[model samples]
Target: MSTSKLFDSYKLGPITLSNRTVMAPLTRNRAVAGFVPNPLSVEYYAQRASAGLLITEASQISQQGQGYQDTPGIYTQEQVAGWKKVTDAVHAKGGHIFIQLWHVGRISHSSLQPNGGKPVAPSAIAAKGKTYVNNGFADVSEPRALELSEIPGLIEDYRVAAKNAIAAGFDGVEIHAANGYLLEQFARDSTNKRTDEYGGSIENRARLILEVTKAVVKEIGAERTGIRISPVTPANDCGPDSDPKKLFDYIVDGLSAEKLVYLHVVEGATGGPRDVAPFDYAELRKRFKGTYIGNNGYDLALANKALAADEADLIAFGKPFIANPDLVARLKAGAELNKPDQATFYGGGVKGYTDYPTLAEVKQAAE
Candidate 1:
């Protein structure tokens, strides 16, 4: 019944985390106008500050990176200021925070894009699904392929965002290369149909992510930057990777060369359309020598098993962290957890976000 591994302190770059349970970035779409993190976000994050680490939800690096309404941005002065509050709150609670940098790429609709411009991707192909817009989920629009000249600018955007994150008092930043986002659009072959330097070959396709990570590391220290990848996930409009294992190996090797703080891998398809890709996660865990955070539909038992088997150095929990702010304590004490209310997951008030009962509350109820 020991949970020492989960409770042990670990070093991520220059910072040391008190535990190995990380709060995974989750989209709540609760920001204020102009995509600023609201006070509610402050309270929400502050409430969950007991975790070893907390990664803010996917935040756009620029206006064009936005896709959904109300999701926060990291590009503007106002947004940075807003995020500063959340970082301050987490820090005051002795918790480490990392902002997740994101760009929706072709998954966005014109309504969501700034200046009504076309959503840009590696190819001009449109995603096969709907995008959440002002009204609701609407059919996705065709995206314009980014010219080779545009790639460097996009990488620079990430660099600036990483710098902004550090300015906002965050310990580091996690590049959102997962869940069919911009970086994933480039990593997967189906969305990247270009014959240019950024397409066709695996190294060519992974160029943007590698360059972006390196640039961010240059802006901040490599020890303070991490990248999240979902090699098996097909969320949004991304399709099956032609050779996931090879593509990811090239990516992991390139990232390992940077000596990043950690690599967050979404191990399986949680609810994404695609079935989980056939590959050995143990191979990935070995390939990436740095700290490994395994995510996607993991329960307490499964997470412990992964740790015991040396399959992962850390465990990132999404929904569980949402419903149980004191998730680490619950696991340590073997307490039953509160179930998450899906309806209040996104764009809602504090009921589902902050009202979840902790172990103390459940024990009080029993009394």
Candidate 2:
């Protein structure tokens, strides 16, 4: 228990991590107007530079891909320059960072989209929920179903975003294919109602993700690329398939052919409704041959167990990393963790962002 397998270093493509503890991408909604990262973001990430690998908050790949206000983007010159400050800060602390390129699909409101247009999705279905916007929460609009011909443009957005991430000085890029995003919408049968080559059968449903990954790997070598998948998650108003295992099996198999750097899988929501379903995390670990990062509700003990049992090559901690900037150090020393302030999680200043103390500060307090 004292010496955990999670503490071991592992090679992720061309980069070597100090350990297997990864900081999961978390949206803080603290970006400036026009979705540009600010100096505060630079400070926020640099403070957590001890994580083995840091996956930045999901960043929009295009204007149409944006689902919320103040979330950073990667497709523009200003945004790329903005993110460079963040990457530079993390690298200065000797940390490796990956930008997670995202497209929200149906989980969006018109206020967050271009020209006040409807959100775009695999189908014109409306997410049965509300979305956070600049003002506050708003009902999701009926999304416009993308045409068959329009698919390539979306794929190209991801490719260009990967290139932009590299230009921003990111060590790599992770395709945000999970958590009910655009790619997940296509992967799940319930959301994708198309009869064309991109829908219906498992292979067809998984085609867009494969194409996007191929394009990204082609744009930037496969060694500098990673993908994330949430097989059974119903977050962000995503619908489930009749057979999730069959769908994901084909998806993972297709991605394996690319020989990408790693696959980050969210088994289910840690404490949400999705956690009620039965899932096989161990099976997913076996299915993905590359480095596997397991996310959701994992503590230091569970992370160690997963690593020792070969259930995951790495562990991604979300909220824990939010409050504890020195998450890796705390995990290694078995120190008490800082409780995250849910009130300040979404949109905030320095209160819950970069003010958390490291173990050194706490120990000094006692003395």
Candidate 3:
């Protein structure tokens, strides 16, 4: 398979992708009241429906999973109806989308948790960051360490969320085990100090992640399940694992058994220096033995190189998709890429969200 080109179609499990360009899950914080996907979200996602696969922004499995303000959830009937509209719009545009299930763990503020409960995690440590709330950033609240008995309930949350995603009409679902979230906290030893079956060794630290993966897979077949892992990403403050290669190699090896559709990996720190740590993507890839979508700072040339080298089956683009709705076409034609406006990247009223033009519009403006 000569995978240098982005326009080539590829079979990803049950569905065929039009191209290898994947729109990575990005948090736009545009959900309406009740944490439901809004009409604006429908337009926002439909605009970039050209991707081979569209992974929606991390949707909280429960209110306790929410870390940011106005982020959508898949926990309620209203939320499911809202996502149905978003997924329907994407399908109508001839695209495939996966909902990313997330839990913020210690990276959340009390205001974001249900009834102002302290965010829960594998340990009581607090993440060194601020969570966006009501148009401003608030200090993250310290979390309560999960009692051994609570593990079952947390895993059930993921299972229910997977079912909700299917009910909401998503073609598949991605478990967000990456980037300093709940799953990652359990996987990383930096914050997890529990001395039980869920912590201590690499396997124990990764217990929750693998358990959640298995539960979700049971609810929505392994073929419809994918997971993202950030081995060394220090973003949101739950990273720089004590032994990233050991921890992730164990994770990748364990994941090989679940028969997951794909394993999304951020080569290094999430959107940070590639050499921030000593972890190796090649090593992790070799252990996984499945479809891999490599992410973090991939451009056309890098993506092409990775594809040609068999480094990744698919390449996920994040910030680039924000500024270029027709990312696939632009990469194919080698056109000038639009610069993204950082001010409007987080919260906004469709300025940087859906206002980006397509390739044709860019060509016309120049003419």
Best by lDDT: 3
lDDT tens digits, residues 149-220, model 3? 988998999999999999999999999999999998999889889999998999899999999999998999
Off by over 4 Å in 1: 271-275, 365-367
Candidate 2 clashing pairs, residues 3+ apart or interchain: none
lDDT per residue for candidate 1 within 53-115, as digits (tens), equals 899999999988988878999998899999999999999999999999999998888887878
Residue 169 shift from truth in candidate 1, angstroms: 0.4
Model 1, residue 41: what's the lDDT?
A: 88
lDDT of 2: 0.88
TM-score of 1: 0.96
Q: All models: lDDT?
A: 0.88, 0.88, 0.90
Q: Per-residue lDDT for 179-236 in model 2, tens only?
A: 8889999989889998889888888889999999999999999899999998888787
Q: After superposition on all CA atoms, what RMSD does each candidate show versus the true structure?
A: 1.6, 1.4, 1.7
Cα displacement (angstroms), candidate 3, residue 338, comes to: 1.1
Return model 2's CA RMSD, one decimal. 1.4
Q: By lDDT, is 2 or 3 better?
A: 3
